[model samples]
Target: MKTAASSVISDNDNTPAQSIPRSPRLLETLLANLDGVVYRCRDDAQWTVEFVSEGCLQLTGYLPEELLLNQRISFLELIHPDDRQMVRAHVDDCVRLRRRFDVEYRIVHVEGAIRWVWGRGVGIYNADGEVEALEGFMQDVTERKEAAQALQEAERRYRSIFENAIEGVFQTTPDGTYIAVNPALARIYGYRSPEDLIVSLRDIRHQLYVEPERRSEFMRLMEEHGSVSNFESRVYRRDGDIIWISENARAVYGDAGTLVFYEGTVEAITERKLYEAEMRHQATHDALTGLPNRNMLHDHLQRAIQSARQKGGLTAVAFVDLDQFKYINDSLGHQVGDELLKTVAQRLMSCVRDSDMVARQGGDEFVLVLQNQTEGDVGIAEVMQRILAAVSRPWQAGDREFHITSSIGVSRYPTDGKDVETLLKNADSAMYKAKEQGRNNFQFFAPWMDTQVSNRLEMLISLRRALDQQEFKLFYQPKLSLKDGRIIGAEALIRWESPEQGMVAPDRFIPFAEEAGLIVPIGEWVLRTACRQNKAWQDAGLPPIPVAVNLSPRQMNQALPEFVANVLADSGLSASWLELEITENVVMKDAEKTVATLNTLKRLGLQISVDDFGTGYSSLSYLRRFPVDALKIDKSFVRDIARDADSAAIVKAVISLAHILNLRVIAEGVEDEEQHAFLRENGCDEVQGYYFGKPMTVDDFTDRLRKEAVQAAP
Candidate 1:
């Protein structure tokens, strides 16, 4: 085939005399082996083919002689129908100009195949410069054209993915310069466009990453492992805002094993990071004040001890307790109590260095860790002084200004037994000592401090026995109707009658019982006893009046309403004859749960009263939701109502508020006629205080009821 093409080339150089048909073997051999057709045809409408090479059989599935001079088919018919007019116009323009023409168009083969072909040719002219014939070479370039089109379509698809993907995609050099970035990348970084991002962000180390070391870490990972996944970092956006981002990236290498760039995808994980942080904070810190809680405090204390041991320096664990916090909490409300805690937390933080740790060890108790104290007790004393000053500062809740102080107990490391538990115990013991020695002062642990703990243990044992021995007795205080001056109801107060001791007041044992978790059982006993006694009185032909029993905070659980219903049923007493008194603090603790419980109790037809109404931080919004029937003004207000204008105002306001809510108002501790007249004038429905009668034993109360019944008999 090479020799034939060489001979054809030699023949084309021959003059006319030498070209006189020397068998035409070389030209015929070359044409027969060629892959494309060589043709000449008239430049007319039919595109008459005058001659065609042997390669026409392969190119168009037709023998060379079959298409010669319009013998069988016109060459124009082989061109695609849609492209025929275009082909004709192109050739005509080229012919008129007498220049070579090149075009690509589809053609049909005899076997019903459509193939793309490239045609390059020039015009042969006759006299008067008119076009006579056209000469051209056509090649079947279908495979090449299809390959080129496939490449273009693949590029278009990749471009679409780069432009429209939700995750940001980027390509950058090893030295922290961006090479290419997609639209998603620009949007993720708060940029207007990809071009704008590329132009503005030049240094990824300083300009993009909030911490420049993150970029170095990224490059180090790529260099060592060739890829990185889930590499999270805090970065600065185009708007100069910080956000969290996670990257999945790999090194893109050149053919010579050199790193061309780093290609990666980025996800903005700011919200995810924030949510995780909140979860972690909630786990380790107090939700109310955002201070480290007991769980975190233990860990921090251990770490501080370890640091102190290694440095051979002293560390102080100071247990801080707010003085009279419980009184303030019970008298004012838990809302005020929480505010006091938060205020104390801020002051405690202000007293310590940045290296110190302040942690909340449950309610009203905080623990501080003062580490690296080489100056011994003097340094701790200075901090303690500062703490005392800060905590003693005046603060306000509502319209009233309050002065608060803290009692701190300090235990030095190595001196406090060198462990987290021991240090905390000693500190706590010393805190109690400080409280005993007149609060608002600091105390160091003494070896004899174990007495306080032993006393607590003894009280727990006695309390548990007191419950088993039925040493608890109920005393009833009569509630008098202010309008008619007659006893209408009575409050059942629990009294502990110990065998080894005289009568124990509620305040002496109730707090210990509550802390020891014996309150729930004790409360149940009180309820049962009160119900049975009231029923006995009614059975004995005495005038029946509603009997009120206080519900402790711990006893106000999901089981209380059902328990009360069962007690009423057991005693055979009408629900209308029973009243359950719940404290304001108890009701406000979990408002939704309290509402549900109160509604259930209400369904049982028992009278409910908010005991100590003005004392607690009860919101009127939640107050309206409670299913209580009355509000009991606390004895504290009535004890000095006539002497104190504030007390008088509070009593009147409560009476008005209760009436507005359609609830009955009862005043307690009305000791004189002046207080009674003040309450009666303000429309107080009932008064329960020494003015009417003191709390009496069951026998005394039964006798008194009988006397009243006899006197009422007309």
Candidate 2:
């Protein structure tokens, strides 16, 4: 009988009988009907096919006669270009191990279509166990291969989203352990890496949240609602830094409705929180001194009134005005003025109890509300005295010591009025009275003081209309050279001819102007008018002398130098023909800045002079440093120089000092020959007063100049 392995050969009469076996019909039927090809080939380079089954037509769309025996194409030619090496290596490995080979790869079909195929093969051996030929089966598996590739792509997309999200994404177990966290989550918690944060932060309730209650609250919300939207909390980072966070999360559950874990996104909101806080503070507090402003003060005052009324207690509303604050600001500087106000605010706060409040009512003004002052004015009086003493204590600004005082006006509830407006008005009126009484004192509100307040209100209103109505004029007074007894220059002074109030002097309305902040514009008008008039006189072929203009303390600022230069250019006048006279105290204020400003003016070729000398606290050291060309003696010393030895000594010393410093000295307010002779003998370079010429209108001054020009023609 023939072996079964030999019976698999075809019935064709080409093969030798030794290569065949018995039972050929059954074996051939099985190989032909099976779903794949069964092949036999020599163990050679081409993996040549020697015997092929009928199934070759179904697997590769080629008949057995076409592929067997290398008739038309070798079996290796059917393998795909990309999978040929892998198929050959698998067959070789199986042959070396003496085992069957199994692999899945691609093959080119007869119709030129590429198809995925499964292959199996084994090396044939003789009795001596030496290889003879190879055999294998292959079948189509294209659908299964495509399905696997699609699955891999989906997984890759999911992983990318999890890794690169901007909002911190997290998954945590119900027991408060982190299951997964993205890189963004690591950064939000100030961690070096997501692994570090997940491994280290075990107790989310106590470790992650700044307040443990926040985590508890989050859990409670999720338990009831199964989700939390826009839940806000303060959280601690890995470095122990606190920040605000907003979270939107939901409870994740299994298919059986059992709690699985929590998943969420987190966003940082610390910057938004801080911005809101800053806006709230700016809305209710003074920006300059960081004190409660007018809006907050009114609210507090009303609350105090309501509480005092409920308890049947007394409430005192004290209005505080800084004494000589304007003088200090004008003579010193605004920087110093602001420092003084801040210092005064702190002192006022110290003088009051915790139940009391001190609020800024605007510049140089403060309001205090003392609630439950059952002892009435007596307790209020004590507080006022304390504030007075506190403010009067000397403070230093840039090595210069200075003192300030306050005038307080107190109005009691039920005595002044029940409402906020009436109480504030009464306190303000009494404050003015305190100022009138030489300041540095306190006064209680009286009913009869209404007229003074009314008068002040009326004056402020009328002054506003005065500038628009053109009720202002300038007067010029001649300055005479003491040596030549001739008119050298003229001082320009401002006067108001009001329609309602006739002939108002500067002293009356200038204070109102300064307080209302209208002086800057008014001062500019004065400067332009003086420069234009001086130019007009020179154009008329009159003597060209320097026209001196007094600069108010408010006008003596850094902007003044540029403004003066512009006015000279616009008026077509030479800067050399203008003299700017600033007060001694104004120059002494902020010595460094004043020096810079004075140098700028000097560069414009205009003359700079110190007016009203000896009336203010003038330091000799600073005086030598000023870029001034002239000094004007104040009338106080000039009035009594002949009678008073001290006044004579002061005048002589000033004149001598000015000459030594290369500054020309002019004595003001010389009313008689004796005062004039005294100033001249003491080396006064110039004189200006009634003795020389009084302040006259433009027309009068022009006439005087013309006559002097005529007299000098000889």
Candidate 3:
């Protein structure tokens, strides 16, 4: 049954071209009934239609019965105007070559829309082999042609991306030979052309390598991880100068999981590497001195410790501090101070070994790493003492000869500390001990230094919490008239009564507070509290005098005008009743800025007094520029006024200088009648000391005032 059915289908397929029993009329009827137009016409100006099918009416929206055998229109007239030349060329060319005639063109419908029709067949040949008639099939193949065109456009887009992508896309063989590369890849690898690179860079591990191991490393990472990120290395350029490159790559695998080649993008990273190095250096070193700053010091110390441990050698960690650097910094200008620091750094460098490290711990502090000290602590100590001597040598900054001294603290490996932080800290503590023993000296690590560290730590903790807990109090010392011996005003001093330790004195804690940055807030509290207390006194009918308050250098030099204004507002006191007592150190350190700041304060009606006048570097020329109302001759000059001739001379000169500047001179620390006699003889204006009565509480002060009032009436 299957064989009989298949034979019937085969006969049915060939039945269309088989001989027909129909006559010519039946053939004409067959042509009119066909689903497409079948035509033959002369190729001329009017190639009129010879036959038309019923389908022609449906195709061109025209009645085919009206236009048969050139009754109304020619087939050439239906051809689109724009495609006429192309169709004519194909037909004429085929005739000229005696080739088969096949062509496609657009034809306009009666309604004026264009449709594409494809024709195929061959040119009829004459007896002499000259073309006579053309026979072909016309079909609507517009859908198939559009689909082929879309495929071509899509291929062109992908080809464009593959050619011009910025990333160097490449493919290579398993043995690392280049197979193909884009134009971008060739430029990235510093080659003239992709073809040239492929030919010249046969062995990527050899000819293209700046570092031979780069290829090996690349292969190793690819094998292990199947991909690599930021795979960076140097490769030789065509001119042999090395350039940096980083690859983000993956391994392409073939069937059976065998590695085929590496495929990735190459990016030139030479400028990026150089920029990174520059940024790293900037982060780790001081810009002014070009020295390794505190950021780099810890790592260097750690590395030094590691090296010392390997050789079983001692690591000598020395903390270097320039003694009296502040004195010089305040005495000379900052320019000279900076030059001195540079000189000191040079001296420190000269005294140490080439392998050793020196780092600036900020300010005048330096940390030295002396690695591989063979003779133990003694050898390190000797080197440190030599460093002290070397740094202490007199050096000139411009025309002025200056002398400097350094304190060295030594901490050794496996003894004082086993790590960076501990070693650095111990060295710092030991350096302070050297400073205490008098600077320009060296000291080794001792157990007693821990006591100092613990005290400092405890003090810092107490200072932070002291304000919150209200453990800080102000003590008011009266400044009496040297002529009448009467209390005119008082100076407010801070005393800390800690729950842990009782009464931390100003002398003991003020320096620590300044160092630890607690003074800024603490100083503010003192100023406000002093002002408030003076206001209370005035409200309670006690005579109001300018309440003098000690100002630390940190507080005086930084934003003093703003702080003073804020304090006065908070305390409900006028500036005329408040005085800011600034030490000469504050005045001398940047005289121009100090003068400007003081003038601002003075404009607000606050009085300025120079405290400890003779102890600091002050110039008589610049002294006149300060907005000072009074000068407090330092206690040093007053202590030996009756005996020491130099002390007497300085005191007399200060008193005379103060009077000449119209600033009243106040002598501090007048402990006896003899000291008073001497100061009175020198024409001093104010005296404040134990002889006048020590710092007293408010109630005691009021009682003293009442008694003095009664005594005066009598």
Candidate 4:
């Protein structure tokens, strides 16, 4: 029953038993009530136990007598195999040095389960200091040790996730300096390692984000709401490539409730942003021409109207329709038609200022919105003129030269309807009016145009019906030799003899025919009829004078030469007995192609002349290049030759120029003796006018040819 303190005092042999402060029985009671074992053992290899307290049963699962004196088991054998050597070495070194020792190790219990223990002991030395015993107190510490191990395992898992996660993770101080960053974050920033990113990017506000204010915004959001989700921004990578990123972050606070740092996850979003932008563009723009489509046009027009209303300025909307586009589409195939539309889109874009917008309303229709026009209709009219000219310019479709024109109708803001739909509708009505007046022109929207649209549509229908009903005729105008005053040739002109409308002039219906694409068939009729009449005259033994047929601008195509040859053959008229008359503008358009066509016609043994010679803006160089046998002076110049000095000079100059080019000159519209004398004195080779004879019927022309043949009898 002796306590270790009392036993040590009694065994000291130096007044210990008498001087002890407490009784051995009392100390032994305290030791028995302790939560651990109090033990004494000899400093031997087995650590032989000399005495052990009753608590030994609880600490090591052994009774005091079982471990005392090594009766059943030595205390050293109780130590776990893994910790035995470390325990022995530490205890022996502390005992040899006469110092206290503290150690922790695992030990085996009576039931075979492992338990962690902490032991504290010191050497009990002999008076001579040569021998000693070891005394120690041992306690089970399994619960605390296991708790520490569990905490360590949780920390390991957290670090693993931080290192290997796909999204970037970071901890940054309030001043924008990185406190800690995972490897994933380093890779996201284009850095070799987290250390590299931390060292290289000192200022996240300026160095990392493309806009420095983004960092400020992020901080503001965190300050206001304590966290941010889907905070999007543009940031710079280490290599300086800009990319989009979205951050989800929280402001981390310390125990004192003060902001410590920001912790966040970042995701790259550049690809998603680009995809959205592409989708937006596709929705607003035309697929074929890359111009704004109707959806965007409405949006633009609405904006323009709003702006014009606010500024008290004018906004003009032009609705454009391509003249005779359907005929071109039907005849040339949709591929060529699509190409022509694309070219026209480009031309239309070039005619306007950058402040204006051009949009494809669909098919052959386009809408232009002109904004902030202080000059009102004057400026709009100028732009419309430019558009008309640009659209009418010659373009190629396949191997053929084509001249297409546009009819434009303009509607003004406040004056025209104020809404988008009304403005567009009014402009459309005006465009139909342009077609009625003659295609290839522009008109301003008037209130009356709404009512006239139906009338125009009816006229178009009637014109189409006329062709099918064979209500067209060819009238011949005699071309007299100015040198001899006799009929040498005739010009074939078309006249529509409608039962409903009576006789219609060429000017009234020819433009509509050209616009509706009926010109090709109508022109063929004229050519065939003229050729047959000339052949009949020759067959009747009348003089075999050449008959000239006028060519429409639309008729001047790669197929024209073959078509004319076919007509000549079908009519049984020799090619030599036929002549083709092309206007100056038609020949000047696509000049290279025109020259090739003229040379082809000449090779077919026919005559070609430049009709209406001085009207078009033709280059003299192109004039020299045109392969024609004659130049017919336009009526405008010939009509005023006797009175207007400018007209007279132009007439004389044209004759001289024609002579110099080895081409004959013919003056038409000569209604007076003075005009005839003026042309004849200028060495004109031929003349055609009312003064000689107006355009007459085929029978009348035939009789006139007969009289000429009789007058020339030898």
Error of 2 at 408 (Å): 2.6
Identify the candidate with maximal lDDT: 1
- Using alpha carbons, what is the TM-score of model 3? 0.57
Model 4 pairs in collision: none
What TM-score number comes out for model 4? 0.55
lDDT of 3 by residue, 536-568 (tens): 878877667888988877875547888788889
Q: Local distance difference test, per candidate?
A: 0.87, 0.86, 0.79, 0.87
lDDT of 2 by residue, 1-714 (tens): 555455445444669976554566767888888877788899898888899989889878888898877888888888898999988888898899999999999999899998898888888999998899987777778888878877888888867887888878899998789999989889999998889999999999989888899888999999999999999999999888999999999999999999999999998899767744554454466545667877678889999888878888899999999988998889887657877988888999999999898898878999998998867788889989998999899988888888888898989898899999889889998999998888999999999887566786788788778777877899999999999999999999999898877899998888778777888878888899999999999999999989998887888779988899999999999999999999866886678898889999999999989998866546667888889999998886787788767568668877877898999998999999999999888889999999878999999999999999999997
Q: What clash pairs does model 1 have?
A: 49-69
Shift of residue 153 alpha carbon in model 3, Å:
3.7
RMSD of each: 17.7, 21.1, 21.0, 28.2
Best by TM-score: 3
Model 4 score (lDDT): 0.87
Kindly provide the TM-score of model 1 when superposed on the true structure, using C-alpha atoms. Answer: 0.54
Candidate 1, residues 175-285, lDDT tens digits: the string is 888989999999999999999999999999999999999998988898899999999999998878999999999998999999899999999999878745654565467
Pairs that clash in candidate 2: none
Ranking by lDDT: 1, 4, 2, 3
Enumerate residue pairs that collide in model 3: none
Alpha carbon lDDT of residue 392, candidate 1?
Answer: 93
Return the candidate ranking by TM-score, descending.
3, 4, 1, 2
